[model samples]
Target: MIVETDGYIDLIQYLTENLPVLSEQQGSKAGTSSYTLRECFEEQLSVQIMSVCQQNDLDQTMRIDIVREADAILYDFEEVLASVLDNHPTLEQEEFVTEFIGLIKNLFDARVKA
Candidate 1:
């Protein structure tokens, strides 16, 4: 639930296999779309981290450390995803971002339960 490296790899695989392709009718500039996706991810991650910390009754210091670690992991995962998407130009960015956010949320929920 803490999403170690293996869990991150699983997330990447899940996104690759399950993400839906956007229809051609939904047109948007790639840069704007990417920025929107990034913003959504940041916001969702913040909320999820806070929820997890609160549910688990973590102290302030522990919450900060866990958030910091999660952020770092997410940043690294984003970089890896960017590289993969760069190589596979046909994939829809929006779907990937959406799936990634969902995976992160699920991971946080599991961590809280743990």
Candidate 2:
């Protein structure tokens, strides 16, 4: 049910822009103790993707693939994405949370099925 449609484009841009800040807000406990999978995903996938977004080398598709791969490895990836989207106070689309989760699941399935 997913394709490279307008929703996909919006989801990707939103993720590319906001996920980094969300991760920062989530804030990894630096020198405290052990880390949760969410923490790892935030640091590895979210933060790293922000850096990748800053660089001019990778295309949007490449960025998407990176997110998909990261999702494949992280448990509850959909929840993570939803939380990121849900927590945004300035988010324009108020009702896009569930649909965005589906879009992300599509990408996640693509990576996993491959």
Candidate 3:
């Protein structure tokens, strides 16, 4: 919900800094993000969001709360999310997106229950 409200970039930036250190290897880290690494998700989401806005005739730039706009365009996500992942051809991207969605959903679910 916050992602929808604030847009995903802030969360992505926070996660880039806070994403768990799952494992480390030989001066390389896996499953974490560098600030620039965040650009990939930001760019892809922006592109997909723009496409959704265009198709729905809703200007995303006019959105005061991105998640709210996205909340209204829920069906579009199921379609766009796949494309976003498709645009990125790396296991890390897939894993990051999937896991991030899971975490966000779980968080939202918990909030609703409360």
Best by lDDT: 1
* Residue-level lDDT tens digits of model 2 in 1-114: 223445545666775565555444323332233543244344545544455445436667866766665555344345445555324322222213334454555553453344
Model 3 spans > 4 angstroms off = 1-10, 16-87
> For residues 14-93, could you state the per-residue lDDT of candidate 3 as single tens digits?
45553332122122333334433334444445555544444454334444444564454343334344333223224454
Which has the better lDDT: candidate 1, or candidate 2? Answer: 1
- Score each candidate by Cα lDDT: 0.57, 0.46, 0.43
Clashing residue pairs, backbone N/CA/C < 3 A, model 2: none
Arrange candidates, best lDDT first.
1, 2, 3
lDDT of 1 at 110: 64
Tell me how far the alpha carbon of residue 110 in candidate 3 is from the true structure, in angstroms, after superposition.
Answer: 1.3
How many times do residue backbones clash in model 3? 1
lDDT of 1 by residue, 1-114 (tens): 364656766875665464334212244544444344445556656766676776787767767777776777567556654434332222355555555677776766665566
Lowest summed-lDDT stretch of 10 residues in model 2?
A: 86-95
TM-score of every candidate relative to the true structure: 0.57, 0.30, 0.33
